[model samples]
Target: MSMARTVSDTRLIFGRYLRQTLRSKVAVVFGLTQPLLYLLLFGPLLTRLGGVRGFGSGDAWQVFVPGVLVQLALFGAAFVGFGLIGDLRSGVVERLRVTPVSRTALLLGRVLRDTVVLVAQAVVLLGAAFALGLRAPAAGVAVGLLFVVGLAVSVASLSYVLAMRTRSEDAFAPLLSAVTLPLMLLSGILLPMGLAPGWLDAVSRCTPFRYVVDAARAAFRGDYATAAVGEGALVTVVLLVVSVALGARRFRAENA
Candidate 1:
């Protein structure tokens, strides 16, 4: 009964948030601009380095598109906390606190909405990539999207938790920048870490995003059984579990 209630509540909250997102067609289109720019501008340059070692195992499109997808998930979902902070300021969260909604549903619903948006943006990005010459197998692209979903859920949940803690965009924005910038650089989301110096490469291995990027790239190249895929899947699952748990706990505590 509790599980059913949570599912029902999650669907209700997801519908509410998803409806609000649909109302802003401009926001949806603009969200793709950054990744699309990377695909259009930075992507062509990668073609020049097609033969470069450590650029990964496929054409420039394969390597570059996967990295751009990861970047989309990282930058896109990481900023979602700004909306939550807005809600907090406008008393939206406070109003929800008095409702009988399940706390887990509250977090899951928002996360689901985020995951849906990210997936749609990803499809658009992939369509553009195809037009520009990307040609990965259908199954591989599907698997890569699974990674994106995991990434979206993990990052959005944590963003919400962080927003609730800081409860101020002033504090949240700077802190997020500090964290995301390093993660982006170290995770090899632009170029492969293989191109990095040995010590730098070793350090990148310590970051979970690095493994996920490697896995997504590997999937894009049709290398599904590789160690990189396993590691990325494991890291994504662990991160997803931990972040969702933390977000739900924080929501309950805040509303309790």
Candidate 2:
């Protein structure tokens, strides 16, 4: 297919899903609830520990808000497969498979919709964080949100691939939970891994999310040139490329 054609198809698919999402205004608002809860309930606790080293150089909100944004992206994008699974069970995918849409567009359109929803939620989370006294350079917050976009794309693409493979909500839910819980804890989304024991911190370093979290914190501190930022950007690019490739290939196979 021509690139133009593919782009058109992607836009069409994206518009369809986005409209569906926008119609349910409550979902968009409710989506921010989890991160907001953490900001309201858990964030203040970090205020007292602001003097503690390894929580990053900024105030507690600075260190913590970035982590929560990442958490929002990590958890929010991770389970998007549930929607895909529903589409599969309801014959949505079966219907699309017979369409003339570019196979890559079929995947990209869905992932892009997910990316938009996640970025919006991240913005709302940031606003709440600001109201609650989180402060960071605007440029740094923008960089952090860019990271959220990359993470959302990577995770959501892989999620769609998994949903297609399993095709069963019962099996998919447990399997996804088993995988995401570990990634969440190890990624230091709620607390700095610096607070972890030596062995635990070492293990966390092995997770790609650790670097991403560290990068966001550094960015929030307005230190953009740091090694953490470079590493996180590199990891995000690598994961995004790999995951999108796998997702596109799966879409092609399924639609073939």
Candidate 3:
């Protein structure tokens, strides 16, 4: 009964945000533009430079598109907290605080909305990638999309928790950048970490995002049953659990 109530509450809140998003068609278009630009401009250049030492398999888009898709989730979902900060500043969160909705639902609704938006953006990214010579199996693309959603859930939940903690976009931006940049640089999103210096490659192994990128690459190669996929799934599950727990706790505290 408790779980059912929370699910119902989450559905209502999700519907509210979904309607707001639909009312702003430009948001949909612009949200995907960056990834599309990378697909168009950067993708071909990588293909041209496939002879470089760091390039993998010479199927450049196959290598590049998975990274770009994960990059899309990395940068996009990590900053979703900005919206929560806006809600707090405008007293919107406070209004919701007085309601009977489950605190978990409050956070899940927003993260779920982010997940939906990111998935849509991923679809656009995949389409552009296909047109640009990406040739992954359909199952691989579907699995990659699933990973994107898992990533969205984890990252957006943490973003909301950070928003609740900092309560200011100005402060959140720097802190988020500090974390995101290191993760991006070390995760081999633009290039495989194997090409990095031995020390740098060793360091990247410590970052969870690298596992995700590797798993996506493997899936792109149609290696669904590999150890990389298993490890990636494990990391994502752990991340989602931890992030949702922390986000829900913060939301509950705010309401209390």
Clashes of 3: 0
| lDDT of the candidates, in the order given | 0.91, 0.89, 0.85
In model 1, pairs of residues that clash are: none
By TM-score, rank the candidates, best first.
1, 2, 3
Give per-residue CA lDDT, model 3, range 199-253, as digits (tens): 9988998998888888888888889999978998898889889989998889888
Q: Over the stretch 77-187, how does candidate 2's per-residue lDDT look in tens digits?
A: 888898889888889888987878898998999988999999888878888899999889999999988887898899999899999899899989998999888998999
TM-score of each: 0.97, 0.97, 0.94
lDDT of 3: 0.85
Error of 2 at 113 (Å): 0.7
Give candidate 2 regions above 4 Å deviation.
Answer: 254-256
Q: After superposition, how far is residue 23 of candidate 1 from its true place, in Å?
A: 1.5
After the best TM-score superposition of candidate 1, give how far the Cα of residue 19 lies from its true spot, in angstroms: 1.1
Give the Cα error of residue 151 in candidate 1, in Å: 0.7
Q: Output the lDDT of residue 106, model 3.
A: 88
